[model samples]
Target: MFKVRVLNEEVIKQVIDMKQVVGAIEEVYRLKSNEKTEVFDMVFHEFERGVADMDIKSGHLKGEDIFGLKVVSWFKDNEDKKLPMLIGTTMVFDSKTGMPIGMLNAEYITGMRTGAAGAIGAKYLARENSADLLMVGAGHQATFQIAATLISMQNIKNVRIYDPIDSNNAKKLAESMKELLKDKFLSKYENTDLYDEISKKFNVNFEGVDDLEKAVKISDVIITATPSRKPLIKKEWVKKGTHFSCVGSDMNGKQEIDENILACARVYVDDMNQALDVGEIEIGIKNKTISKEDIICEIGDVIVGKEKGRLSEDDITVYDTTGIALQDLMTSKIVLDAAKEKNLGVVVDL
Candidate 1:
């Protein structure tokens, strides 16, 4: 007597829009800050081969119509095998009766929602005049971070990108971004100076940079989205009034920035429970550089007025995100609704 809609990555892409995601994730943060949601703790499992790992993140929406669960995997050999690094799905159900309503490909959703969270974090925590952005990764997640930041912040002048393993990865990111961004502005320039002309016309420049120190030193807001066991960004290179959004440390013992950065920076997290356990904040706490109490507040609390985000323009702020479940759940609600409205997925009787 019922049916469920199934969506794949291609179908999900048809409905993927950055502006909608940013707005939806922000709305969920308010709901969470007011104590109207339940985001469960994440569970991790390692395959026997020891080269692959899976993460399970689930959550419920109070007084809403849907809940979601996201299961994702990271395999070390994926690139070697010519496979996708991120493979996951989102399972959505009716909140009232516990009936399944939809299932969707989650790779894009996970990256997009995480990107939106960082952009929202920047909106409240970064200096108003923040323009230059330094993205320390050139993979799939880094692209989302750049695209979403450009949407959230206006008058941005420069974006500097770096990747450790593949220098070409950064160059490819710049070209892809140019294609994605060309439609946002009107262009009348020659082929030789197309990139510079586009930047001059839009007053924004995004490109790949080889010097990591120079990138960090000149940036107003820095976003780290790489999976690195060692610290990549140093505290000394970070300028005053800079904001850093650490998005890659979703697993235990993974770090992306120098712990000393958190010692001096006014730190914020998506959720204290998760951030203290696995996020970049966990590194600072483990090293005794800073304690949980040292964290200024959760980004959600800043949205609901329970705590302030950044007190001064000169304040150094760091937001450590562990990929909240509520973000996945709420974002899926929006994606599923849009898919249904557009008739974009396959429906089957259950």
Candidate 2:
């Protein structure tokens, strides 16, 4: 067996840019068109009575680089140390012989897959004339979300970022994004004249939106990446034709948008079972604001042409991203393939 250690951040970057990963997802979505893909069978272990526990989810899919197992572990109250609330690893097997082919650090995979899902959602659901983007969080996922969206939808010209605690972090993120585009194409990504033109065309003003409500109101597409127990973006602030990508709130009790927002919008999810269990949709279900039948489609469904996307020009759309194991497996497959082509990884025998 060959062993490789893929770091979290590096895997995140590779997975974000790899078009093969997105292609794999699109193929899977096409096969499971309009239908909710079968959820992975889960095994739960209780450590303590109510507060402590862990769960392992296992599943299989038929597509490129098929057949895999992802095991995620959850432990609460780890926030004091700045570590992830839940952490684990995933193992991918060779579909032909069932040999263990590779292992990946799950944290990075989760962030990248979630961000990619948002980008895919924006690609299909956002308006074709979309030019300005408003991001609500300045974290790692936010960076990748912008990267994926920029790659998939090449029309974006202005990006407005807002983070309550660290506005400078948002600016730093914008600068880094600019730097990436510069390094890749050898030119400045954002020009002052272009920014001015986009700002005028979109009527966007990032100056006065000190709070979440105002920031969300003006953008064509808004991405909420904050980890909040309470709703951060108000429903009233969301206008018609606005596309919202909820990348945060993958855990229960964490929510970014109001439950009422789901009631008024066409809601899509990465995985229905996972989202209902712990994603933003869980809060809407718990509050009875939206029913189980309210979900429109999965992002994968839209990608594969199984379901309709953006039915109306003025429809309000939201993508509830909970992250999925298949995404990790597919992205890892792409990375491994690339590594083989470029002789990137150390081929240590196991």
**Model 2 poorest 10 in a row by lDDT:** 199-208
- The residue-by-residue lDDT of candidate 1 on 1-350, one tens digit each, is 56899988777766767777888888888887888888876788888456888988888888466777889888878999999867988888898888998888887788789889878877888888888988888977886787677777755778888886787888788766776555422232335444464344344666888888888998899999888988998888988999999998987789999999899999999888999888988878988999888998888899889999888888999989888777877778787888899988899888
User: Each model's number of backbone clashes?
Assistant: 0, 0
TM-score of each: 0.91, 0.80
Q: Compute the lDDT for candidate 2.
A: 0.69
Task: Report the lDDT tens digits of candidate 2 across residue range 239-294.
Answer: 77899888887777889888998999999987787889899899899889998898
Q: Considering every candidate listed, which one attains the maximal lDDT?
A: 1
Off by over 4 Å in 2: 1-18, 34-38, 43-55, 72-87, 180-209, 348-350
lDDT of 1: 0.81
- Residue 141 error, candidate 1, Å: 0.9
Query: Which pairs of residues have clashing backbones in candidate 2?
Result: none
